[model samples]
Target chain A: MSMFPIIMWILMVVVAFVIYIPVAIKINKTGLKRLGATAHIFTCDPDKDPIK
Target chain B: MSIYLGVFIGYFAIIIISSIVGAKKVETMGDFTTGGNSMGLILGVGTSVATWLSVASVMGVPGNIYSRGVCAITGWIAGWFGGTALMPLIAYKIRRPAVPTRTFPEFIHARYDADKDVSPLQIVAAVIELAGYFVFSFIQVQGFGIVLNRITGLPFVTCCWLFMIILVFTCFGGFQSVARTDTVNAILILIGVIAGAITVVNVAGGMGAIVENFATTTAPAVTGGNPIPAGSLTSTWGVFGASAIMSTFLSNSLGASVAPHWVARFMAPKNAKTGALQMFWVVIFLIPIFICIVIIGMGGKALMPSLPEGVTSDYMFPQLIINYLNPVLGSLALVAICAAAVSTANSMLLHCSTSLIYDIVRNIKFSGGKKATVEDDAKTTKVLRITILVLGVLAVIGAIQQWSFLADGFTYVYGAFGSVFFAMVWLGLYVKKMNRPAAWVSLIVGFILYFYCVTQGAPFGLPTFIVSGGCSVISAIIVMLVTKAPPVECYEAYFSDDPSEATVAAMHRIRRDDV
Candidate 1:
């Protein structure tokens, strides 16, 4: 009944899409490379090639 | 009655089948504890979302809204969303290490005190996890009993005992079993909550009617209670006022982000990307589920002006199903509550047992100069199963007593977790100079302050977490500034993208099973 709950709920959805999705995408793209360079675990994406 | 029993048996069969399948995979300690750290995206999202829903989200949120009005959204829903949104960052860092830590305390041990066989810090971390997850498991069991009692017309104590069977069966097979069943539970929960919401909306005579009832109805939440103030249910602050709402928001959002179970979820995924992506998808998936939950809660208030004498608002969702919905739909909704309870209970029980066996008992054994091997891992896995059974019994006992409002029980533990682990986990990951002394001081300060505030009341009517968490962060920073930098091995696995061979070896030594 209060517009407040509805408004806040929408804001939550917006935060998830705008913030979480991009961060996840960035991590997926570059996280392994960053780790491999320093940790030397894998040069390529482990998701694509099984962890060996 | 027959329809309810038939659907319930069918649901149990599916869950038991999944558990049996999951049991086949538990060949080693790693497999049991972290699903061999190989969970794919769908399973990852399913388990995470299922665990996130819990009984609190399904039952307590609606109950809170029914009693407190729309303000319940500020703390539980919005705060949880905010917490989940931040998990990708934590997940990225946690899953990045080459040889990932199997448990959250193991990560803490590797990050802060890798040089030692078993640091006091590891023991302390494990203790906190043990206590937290034990209470968490108890809450889930209590939730399950409440719903089952309503459905079957069983005594409350009997209902609590009935849940232990499901809890043990789901948890005995370990993480993989829990994950598999959780996926099933998540799908059911989605369908059940949505169906219930649609019915609630319809029964309440459309959204406009519901809103009008909420805004204008002079109904008390309980029989003989004072009538609700006009427009209070429609106000932004509602009856809870701003301070309570803000307090709830802080504890739920900030506390949940670093909760041990969530941290372990990051470790269960195969890689950093999967870990991060799983959470992203979980956030998206939960949006609709939570929206429907809001409708169910607010709509319940609209339909039932006040509950009968001595009835708690915690019964709102179940009562709605029984009185308003037909048998088939009602059974489905009740099963969904079962799913929510089982999914979370199994996960929490797993965490509880692992913290006891892997973190505390094995840590002590290994520290005493016993090296870990594959055989030892098998032995440990057996011990973990036994621990689950033992803890399940204890939780059943605790759950027999209706402790508090289901959601409020979570807030207390979340407040403790947020205060104690917030600074230690966040700073330990990002801050290179975060040494053992800082970590120790921060944890103690946070724990003491949180409990003190809880018992003596927080200053300025602020949430206990804000006061305790603030002090903890300040203390950690101050100590870190003065203390010597942590050893290279302690910091490298988390901070250095390319840790040296020695650092890698040290990390491997931290979890000899990985080696």
Candidate 2:
């Protein structure tokens, strides 16, 4: 009921986003070239892959 | 009552159909274990969020908040967010390897054992995973049974067995089935929690009223116990002291970051970027779900004030639904709990079976041997299915006992995992100088300290995981300094941005040619 916990929760969410989003973006940009075709074993086929 | 039953039946039918569809695509061990390492962002995010929002998060967290106060937010939610925040680095490193290991233990072998033999380190990791996930699976079954028993008026044991059937059906189809069903479960959980939160806010009049009631109410957490002091629920640490709150946060967050199931999840993504992105998205999405849970917990306090005599706080969520909400909405909320139970239970069950079959049994049987033949893959897949069934029965037996508080179960197991693997996984992936002796010593030191903390009590009442994890890092650093560095080949797959052709070939040789 005190706003402290809510404030703390929001702070944590912000901290997580700040830490994760950049790393994710960097990985997305560089990851495919780094790993190349060898790692891409499964084709992204909806019928074959578990999730559509 | 009939509406609840119909909704439950419909939920189970949907889950079964999804499993059947997922099972059709499983032609090799890779499909069973890692969803053929082809998960797109949506599926990856779905499974990760669903698995993360275990019954502990849905039921235990609210119950903890209902009983203790907002400290549950710091102890569980914040720590979990921190853990997820740290996961992109892990995902990047883990998925970077050209030939990824299917299981966590296999990754250990591939990283630490230059010879790629079934080393003691791999066996120890598998054993820990087996023990940890077995406990995790038990907790899920216990939570599921508690909810279903409350809803159906069936005997508790009957509800547990019912959950076991669902768990086995979900897990028997392996990672593919688990991931597919998990996506559906994730959606249901989101809707259910949002609806429950909205209903709670409405019943309590408004957010302001709920907050005022929660702050001023002196309701005892358990009936006939001492009333909670007024304003304590709104205090900085809530009812729990700083030490207890910090311990809970550290144990849940740090331990979960390197948890084997999460590591394996990183492997399932289509690429390194997807793995990292999925976790980022999962963290974003869980923000709303956790906020709703907090609202539900606080609002329940405003409405109920205190629970009935002899009833634990774990019953708070279901009791609220039964007492306040309409049948249709209540049924949906109950089904969400079921979804949480099934989504998490299947992942843990898969980890248990895979750790047993692929990590321990096969690693030992085929030590110093060639890569797995097509026939070996077929045989291992069959054995993994059998292990899931057997373990499901064992978990049902364990659940019948109702060992401890629902969320406390995770704290203990996560402590053990974080203590041992926090150094082993994180340092092993990044620190090329870390040697076999360092790995063995850190594991031993961490496990001993963890055991001691659990048995004798941790110093200053800190969580066992914090003490043990600290010791693990210190000992690992000291040992790494004194011991010789591991062979270049051992760490190259994880550390190198672009590993040499020879190193890639070696990595390929270390893993089973499952596809």
Candidate 3:
């Protein structure tokens, strides 16, 4: 098995976790239904209550 | 006759019974469509994985691996894993408002409407979703036809009709039943694939021997390429070259994230935490199954050097099961393939129905177009069920052909969803000033460009996804920069305000039958 592809997969996973986990944790903390604010992932409704 | 009848009948009975029991919960559109947005983490994970693993992953991936080697994993499987990993970032947003949206297209309708009523963007988005998901459901029915023909010796067309009957019973229970039934299917798939992998590995004289044989085996000449030489198994881009591999990876990863059935799963979760956690568990569950997928395909190649005169790589799994494993065990494995296909087909059908009845029809009837009354909701539920039945029959008709257009059709289906929605959903979700014109232009361009590429064989070896997806993103961005955004309140409804909070609290507190 070439380690190159496996390593590339590992990197992709790491990046996904880095981007997703923090937002997930924030959503959990706010007790809010929507992300309630954008740490990341853009919202089409940008004109509304702008997250700090 | 080959040990499938008794097992399949019993399996179908359990699915029907559970689906009926779950159907008892469907008193309103909320119940039928999003399960009242009350799905627990367990069912959420189960349905999500079952929906994600479809016939394509279970049957198609193995076929690819058998023909093209490990590059299949990089091209297809890796993209799925990668795409799903990003789902958490959008899960909460997609399932927005404590009240939750019934379908994905509803989100587009909610976000982009100008007067807080139905808009052209909403209708167009829902129509695209309906068309795309309808085709997806057809492919799953075709997959079921393949398996049924193998087991029962029925004509392919007859098998397609038989599976269509199964879909009605399975889909009639609505989202609640679909989620519950999916849990059962997911468990079966996990067990079947794991067992099938172990049996394939052992039959081929262990993993090391299988690997040795694969490295030295020569591929038979097929329509796509010249015979692949020994040791070329290690080459990432053998006959397909870099572009083909990249195309698979792009469509599988990017296109999948927006697949209607997948987005529908997020809507059913009990809460944001439930949705977010679902992705984690999905990845956990998929790992073993995917490893098994690789083993089955690669191992089959090791043992059989060349398929029997008429067989294609698509038959590798069923061939391994029947020819190698004991009868009882093979029957159990076959159930897994059935489970994978049924779970995906039912979910796709459900989404298609919801888009037709819940998003499009319901939007037309509502004044603010934001909420549906109890009577209106009940009427839509009836419509949704009827739609599911009618769509099931249409899918059966699509499956009557002998050739499994699944491989090529799968790319077109995913690419269609990606081109039409990927830009719209992503931009609609994040970009501040993406105006209606931008959304419209991007959608139209992506739709036309994708079909054009498909018609021309994806010129220069470029995948349909890159052609369409690139057009969607680039055009949306360019247009958004020049066009004025929609009104600020439109943005608030989707992003800033908790519009569904009162309704959610009322539903939880009063349990009102009347809307």
Candidate 4:
């Protein structure tokens, strides 16, 4: 692979990993809200979300 | 005219369909504003990539490539890369403390509790931000006109009017519609780019032939002969050392670190991790499109080997498309150009309306408390819609003003804001100490400095972006440090180890609303 490709890939992975942890803790603690009825990915109903 | 209209209508139909799909259930303020933040990784990444791949992506950028060679292009990618890289650091990791704000300046206000007396100051900063987006949107109007006339042989004014009407409808659907529209537009752009690249290279014989022709042609003593021919970026840094090269890199990082549309992407993402994932996707998908454009650029260089009189080197792509490329694919590329112009301009329009509605109209009187009364919230939404209408009208006026001067008027006016924002955005975010006094100082100083640089022959043939970026960053950082003001809780989050993990947990905990 070219230098640019290698650089962009490593940058993407490392940065994604770096940003992953704190967000996990925040979501785990307070829970989260689904975007809407169609929100397929991440939605913790406010009523049932942890602590609340 | 009919062919041009056919290409335009096809492109417009795809985007409008997506917008209408997204706008179906957007009933609330949040939904209206952020598409309820539910975009998938592909859509998010595609749209962001597409947004970056504006007229600049094809015509503006590769022109820089052909003229400066590979190194100059890489020099630019360094800054563009900086803007992308900083997303997780500046925004994703440090978002919670900022989640409540509506606009970019709101993030500024939330970050620093500057004196309440300086409300006008914040509005001035916003106006400064609008300057770039406005220039950008108007340029897209010209871009649409150029492609329409060039490809299908339509009247320029007719093309400009259609471009304006399409933008107003695309924007009227708000963020949700805009997102979906951008996704389709991005896809169309990618398809066109790939096809155009393939067709051009094949039609021109082959890559080796293209490069050889470029090297052998016209002006002697140019890169292998021609001045603006297909050489590389060996000269600009030919005499300058490693430090000079690094300075170019830092300037882009600094400049892109603060673009309004980029930061606005922060609010547009589904969640923190999704945002990060989206950034990765953008990088992955975008490389090919850029490579394709550069290939076409090389093909153009190979074909003309030199521009005709009264035409700049940038016209190479358009000239080639009109003369070469299979008719069907060339027509599709023309349509994709429209998509590129519309996608970028629509984002600018979205931000302009948001700024007007949230910052200007939302406040009746902030004499006491920072937040407004419930009644204040009631009318803000309608006001935003009205602002959208007014902005649409103004954009149409700007589009109509595309007289003999063509793009020069728009570029000069709009480029002003990009300089200012790129200068101060980071300090305003990470360096909490930058207060109202410093913010104002950096803004004014950066604006004048940028104008001066652009006006005064742009110095080293380098873009005004570098000078303006350096001055803005320096002014913003220096003032913040002098005052020793750090935004409350700013340091803790910015320096934290893992930011998106919290959202990942929320991702797991989420329940389908069924609403």
Candidate 5:
């Protein structure tokens, strides 16, 4: 009678994201090490990065 | 009026809108170009593998089984098989500190930042690889056009343009959207293709009846010219060279693992190990011969016996699906086919866009000689999006020209780049003595020879690979020699034993005495 399936669908997506979060962090962590204009896609030299 | 065509467009609208809205967060250059280095293992592997295995591969593969026997089994298949099998073993070998900093060219540029000895090869590799990718990408879009035209009442060129617009929107989400959509698209293909295969087999009264039908079907008695003289399309070994060719073709696909988008698959997981494992499985599932797509092609040869001569063998599979499967089921399969074409072209469009903007266009110096760095993240995003559109347009224009063979269009060009950079990059990782100059010499030799061979092969259908590969390897070695390389440490020279361990001990005793 209750709308339980929608709750389950939301939970599944959340779980997938929870598992995926660390992997994304690792990729970003690696990207931070690269340096150049767009020669490299994700990287910016850490030493040069104002953000870092 | 075709049910499949309508369904395909319906799905296209949903996915494209989803892509643009979901990817709105990609406000930086990196996000637009590489999905901001944030794809999961499954999505990356799924999309990369799905894009690699396209409608042409799905249809063309089984046609090989029909027209030629085991020989249809060669190059990309064999290479991919070997590569997948070898993946886990070498995954770590490919994991480098600078990967995030690398585009395909950036990787080559760094890995082979050849000493004074090794520079030319890198440039050659870059140029050739880019060219190979460009042609393959163009054909992929064209393959979509063919499938769409066959299913719908629309003009082929119009279908191509419509699909091309879909392609841009899909890529508008950048790497993340592409991967997610492709993962869904691939599963749909697996299901649709399998359904199409079962229906075809059922209609034909199972495998035995189909085989029997195939055996009875003979060529209308040979015309006066005696086409393909002294050979039989009747056997697998004749024109197809099923075994040797199968191995060669599969071997060539190993070369794909190193392609720009494919290798980027390595960047999507917790680590290279996880990504490599995903790739390993993707290869097994996506083998040109394994699944329903290929089966559909064989089904077509049996079920559609009345298919006229010169009906473009590639169209046979789609024709069978449209005629035999239920309208809705057929529509699903058609969507899968269109999706396959669009996804691959999109991937190629992304790679070429990245290369042109990041490598070719941006690298060009001003008339007064000034360069700009990544000044605004938002601006960079806009530029890459524009680059994707520009490349998409160029490829669409090229697709309308109607090439004779999709497979033929890509191979020679890929081989040119593959011969030099493929060998050099692998060696650069392992062989310390190989200098940068050697890479350069090999590149010049490889590109010129490969270009010449491609022209000649156009008329004669000769191989560019063996010719270009042979020259590049020889030249690379010669340049290595001319550089007067130093003797690298071997088993004989582990280290200077600290000028004698005993002498060191004696010196320690004298120091103790002084103390």
Candidate 6:
């Protein structure tokens, strides 16, 4: 209920978002499109599969 | 009883509702295992954080801080946080494999599959994973039982069974259900930590008083028959001393990257970047929660010097909520505590069961020269549910017997997972020479060394993880050089030189090269 505790909680949020959001966004925009292709399901012949 | 009943019923209702909602999205084995590999950043991060913050994070770390010192944060909490930093080393590489694998062991099976058949090494790895996760799940139930026993005055075994039933029912819908419910648990855990911290801070007469007390308060001369050195609260080494703390830090720092439950989360992300980026959000959300737990542990120590004789320090966190906060809020916090345990327990159980059915059983069926059929989606789902039920029952039986082997030595199970898989998986991703023989040798050496060190009481205060993991990696490298290297196709299928489409294609071309 005190202003100090409320201030502490808000500061934690603000600091974390300020640091994280930008990096996340940049990665999403530039890094994601490229990584998306790599993450696509790789089709393979069943007999050639190492684990099959 | 009324407040607790209402809180628990409400919690179960939310979990069931999420299960029903998520069940609609699960139509295939992939969906059942990895949520259809369509999880966006938010859901992926939410579930990751929730699953990672097991009872160890919620109760064990705080209890350690309460009894030992702030170094518990450095050793246990900070170590876990640091583990996420290592995730990028394998995240995109593992996620971008030429083919998607359902379980961590399946990835190992696919990557190190000798002779294009189910590798014996893969089956051994699955067995280890199943055993590790079974103990992990058992501890969750054990933690839950301890709290419920204290609160309800019920026998511990009864409480264990009660939680076992609830956890199994909640996870019956499998990964989708677990993910949706975990998202909810993640939110509640955040709220609970904040609420608990605020209450503790206010009770301790604000942050200034708490800090002053922590700075000035001497650790009790005797804690549960163990002598506590003076001024451990602020000391860097604290009661456990530097070598033990450092060892724990090194071992736990790899916990997230190698643990089967956490590894499964990487497979669910919508894209490679999402898998990599999820670590950032998990750490961001965890930072405040980490700060709050530090306050609770330190602040509680400042206020309540010691528990009555016979009560373990593990009771510190739950007792704070039960005694200090308002009944309604206390009950909510209790739900969060139970949520923490159940959220993690469900995920581990799911991973363990998947390893049993899809990873081990299916491989056996295929190896028996049984002709492979198109896996019937409905049958797979039914078999998976049955597996979940069976594993849950086994976990309940294990939970009833107090395994001091695991419960007392908190770091051993985690150390085993890290020691066994840390070098093998990470090295296998980048080094084309990492063959199945080397992996097998590494795993065997790691297991023997860790258990031998642990049985010898981790002689000279060196941590089991470093000793085992070091020996394992060294032996693996030596073995890889002596044995024939795996064909280039093994490397091509599992890794890309870089996270680019062109590189992926190049890798695949080599993967498909004529034998």
TM-score of each model, paired residue for residue: 0.95, 0.95, 0.90, 0.78, 0.75, 0.86
| Model 1 chain B poorest ten-residue lDDT run | B506-515
lDDT for residue B356 in candidate 5, whole number 0-100: 59
Off by more than 4 A, model 4? A1-52, B1-7, B66-72, B114-118, B219-252, B364-379, B399-419, B422-424, B457-478, B481-515
Error of 2 at B506 (Å): 3.0
Better of 1 and 5 by lDDT: 1
Task: State the TM-score for model 4.
Answer: 0.78
Which pairs of residues clash in candidate 6, taking residues 3 or more apart in a chain or in different chains? Answer: none
> How many backbone clashes are present in model 4?
23
CAPRI quality band, candidate 1: acceptable
| A-chain TM-score of every model | 0.45, 0.47, 0.42, 0.44, 0.42, 0.41
lDDT of 2 by residue, B1-515 (tens): 99999999999999999999889889989899999888787888899999998989999999988888888888888888878888878987898887888889888888888565567788889999999999999999999999988888899999999999999998878898999999999999998998899999998999999988878889997778898899888776887788777778888888889999999899988777667768878888998899899998889998898999887788899889999989998999999999999999999999999998888888777766567888988999999999999999999999999887888888888888898988988898778898788888889998999999888988987766778999998999999998788878789888877778777776766674533
In candidate 6 chain B, where is summed lDDT lowest over 10 consecutive residues?
A: B506-515
Model 6 regions more than 4 Å off: A1-34, A37-52, B218-227, B368-377, B404-410, B458-461, B497-515
TM-score of 2: 0.95
* Model 5 misplaced stretches (Cα beyond 4 Å): A1-52, B25-27, B83-91, B114-126, B220-236, B241-251, B268-270, B287-289, B364-374, B452-464, B481-515
Q: Which candidate's lDDT is highest?
A: 1
Model 1, C-alpha of B17: deviation from truth (Å): 0.6
Per-residue alpha-carbon lDDT of model 1 for B1-515, expressed as tens digits?
89999999999999999999998998888889999888877899899999999999999999998888888888899888878877877887898787889898998898888889877787888889999988889889998898888888999889988899999999989999999999999999998998899999988999888877878877899989999888888788888777778778888888998898999889988777677767778888998898889889889988888988887888899999989988998888899999999999999999999998998888888875467988888889999999999999999999988777899989889889999999888998888899899888889999999999989988988877889999999999999999889889998887655779988888778786545
What TM-score does structure 6 among the candidates reach?
0.86
Scored against the native two-chain complex, candidate 3 gets a DockQ of 0.19
- Docking tier of model 5: it is incorrect
lDDT against true structure, model 5: 0.55
Model 5 TM-score is 0.75
Candidate 3, position B50, lDDT:
90
